[model samples]
Target: MNGAESLVETLVDNGVDICFANPGTSEMHFLAALENPRMRSVLCLFEGVATGAADGWYRMKDKPASTLLHLGPGLANGLANIHNAKRASSGMVNIIGEHSTSHLKYDPPLTSDIEGLARPLSHWVRRADSSDTIAWDTVQAVEQASQHPGKIATLILPGDTSWREVSAQVELPKRVAAQPKVPKAPDAARIAHIARVLQSGEPTLIILANKATRGLALERAGKIAAATGARLGSQFFTARIERGAGRVPIERIPYAVGQATEFLKGFKHIITVETREPVAFFSYPDKPSLLKAEGTLVHTLVEADEDSALAFEILLDELGAAHAKPVLQQRVEVVVPQGALNPLSIAHALSAAIPENCIVVDESLTTGRESMGHTMGAKPHDLINNLGGSIGYATPVATGAALACPDRRVFCMVGDGSAMYTIQSLWTQARENLNVTTIIFANNSYAILKAEYANMGAGVPGARALSMIDIDRPSIDWQAMAKSMGVPSVSVDTAEAFHKAMADSVRTPGPVLIQVRL
Candidate 1:
């Protein structure tokens, strides 16, 4: 058996059934081994799409998928999304192919520092030293990626390793049945300390993130808030948050420093669970880096690696609030607004049309910032924010999410500029016949950059400066773009038109793109 075959077998044995790949020459053997019907190989035109799709797959499937990237340059192209995946705590196995060891001394044009590029984004990085060890390395990579909150495990494979003959595949130890680690219970002293702070009834706020923002943990958090009169909030940008009608809603700390500061203004204590204390996304001139008001104390009930759900349950028990019914958001009627489409009208249209059990991938930049509040009580859905602050994620993530959960509708909201970066995802969505509704906010400019320039205290931009952000030199025909990619699409300018387009897109099957022109 060759190393490539054994590597593929190892991954499949470990439950990694899918691979997103943008392969090249060095990966030829690995690519050939993919002929095995057991492993599904998805061809991504760009490395970023491969990585971003893996991120989406992890979020929806709760397991890591493998990605095959070309050498250093290819890994470099995919780094931004890898960075985003790391921040989201999404698990992925990145298989980067390198030149044969002998060729390295000759300094091939493609040769570069692959490990250096990978280390920044991956929690674990290892290179297969020889063909005999490839399968063993593959097994280790899967284990690293399967941890509770998920992680990125990168394995660098030299070309010679894949081509060489191995006597036999590594005989990995018999797998142990994985039991969800029983979270180490918090001591009575710590629980009492948190309980005391919450019961003090003096403006305590609980910040939730990661696992704490979804499922039963969120419910217990709501109960704690209900019993102690403490408030609940989350970071402005989070990986995935379960929120909608009948669910306990959390006040997300605003993206703007001033607004976030005001949100946490009077709180005397901020309790953190699987999330850090509130901090601004960027340091504004003369603005405090910390979002909370001065003199506010930050306490941690559970750290990033701790089990957030159990921690909150313990806190609820300590407060005698286990049975307290929490306040939940009532269903809000979705209404189609009249007149021209603006941010507010756009939000209203989405609030009305997003389907129940839907997944919303947001990269709408400035336009969709305020839209979350409007969708609070529409229907139960999962909202995925760009925790890594990287652009071009919405479309690919939507593609992967739809593939992961075929029953749920996937809605991708992206701004014009960001949409262009990964527009190829639309073709994949169409080819796979996935259920995806892509809404491209065609404001025809980098709206967030313009806002940032102003926020940075820079004076009004000149014609040249404005030209850099404005995308309207020759307005992009998004309808044509989608149609060219084999997806049905339409352009809409008014709120009613957008609402109709969205509703139609969701009701119908396959991929559809709605270009909302403001």
Candidate 2:
């Protein structure tokens, strides 16, 4: 078998069956190997979309998905989403194509440092030296990606390495049962210390992240909060959280520096879980970087690589709070607004229209910031946020999540400016016939930047400064753009229309776009 065939077979034999690919000439052999029925190949127009899709897949599937990128330039094109995925702790195995070894001596145009491009975002990076080693290298990459909380692993394959036939004498490597690197148990002393702190009667806030924000870990945290007076909080931007009616809700720290500082000032102690002490998203003039009040003590209950559920289980034992009734968010009825599509009205409409078991990918930095708070009591759903502060992540991530959970609908909320960054994601969604409802908030500007300008103590923006942030010079025809990509779409101006669109989109099959003109 050719090296590329072995690599594909190995990936399928292991658990990675889906591949997001944007290939070039150097990757043709590997692309051809994708014809293996066991491996499902998805074509992405941009490398960023491929990487972002892999991130989404890992988030929903709780497993690594493979991505095939072209040369160094291709990897670079994908780096932004890779940065987002790394920050989100989503597992992915990236196979980057490289020029053949012989061609490198001639200094070919496409030749560049693939390893250099991958290191900052990747937890593990390797290059296949020969055809016989490709399968082994792929196995190692998958193992790295499968670690607890997930990791990015990049495997570089030279052109010859993929096309060259493996020698018959070299027996093909069999799939080994990879040992999943589970999260280590927290120290008993540390758990006991935290238990004492919780019982101190001081107003404390337990900040959750990573694996601590969902499932049994979250329920245990709620019990701890119920037994003690501690409040549960989360960062402004978290990777993935399971929330909604019937789930334990977490208070999201405000996004703005001033607001966040104000919200956090009341806590006497801050306990961290798989995350750090609260800090401002960015530094501003005369503002403190840490959000906590003066003299507040910070304690670590669970390290990033530690088992949060286990820690909480032991903490429950120490506090005798295992039987404490945990507080759960009750379902609330939201009235859908009629006229005007402001943030509050939009949020209400969303809360009223969200379907059960939907996956919401949020990148509506400005308009939909309130959506989360409003939807807290809506139908049960999973929420994903941009932890890396990157734009254009919502649509592609929604695409991946929909593929991962084909039975569940995905609602992607992104601003017009951010949507343009990876609008190519629409085509892939359409091609895959994914169950994705993409909502584009067409505000005609980088509205968040406009807010940041004032937050930075810059006076009112001048005409020139406003021009830089505004995209109103020629308004984008979002409907036409959606049509070009073969996805059915609708335009909404009123809250009622938006609410109706959201409710109706899920009923129809395949991908649909809703352009909310604000």
Cα deviation of 438 in candidate 1 (Å)? 0.7
Report lDDT per candidate.
0.87, 0.92
Model 1, range 1-518, lDDT digits (tens) per residue? 78888788888878888999999999999999999798988888788888999999989887889999999999998899898888888889999999999999999999999999899889999999888878888878888888766889999999999989887534643232122334455456777899989878899988988888889889989898889999999899888888899899998889998888988888999999877887788777888898889899999888777777788788888888889999998999966798898888988989999899999999986899879988998888999988888898888888888888889899899999999998989888888898999999988899999988888888799999999999999999998999898999988989999999989988899999999887
Candidate 2: TM-score?
A: 0.99
The lDDT, on a scale of 0 to 1, for candidate 2 is: 0.92
Model 2 spans with C-alpha error above 4 angstroms: none
Worst lDDT 10-window in candidate 1: 172-181
Which number leads on TM-score? 2
Tens-place lDDT digits, model 2, residues 1-518: 89899889889878899999999999999999999998999999999999999999998988999999999999999999999999998999999999999999999998898999899899999999999888888888888899887899999999999999988887765665255568888999999999999989999999999888899999999999999989999998898898999999999999988888889888889999999998888889988898899989999999987999999999999999889989999998999899999999999999998899999999998998889899999989999999998787888899889899999999999999999999999999999999999999999999999999998999899999999999998999999999999999999999999999999998998999999999
Give every collision pair in model 2: none
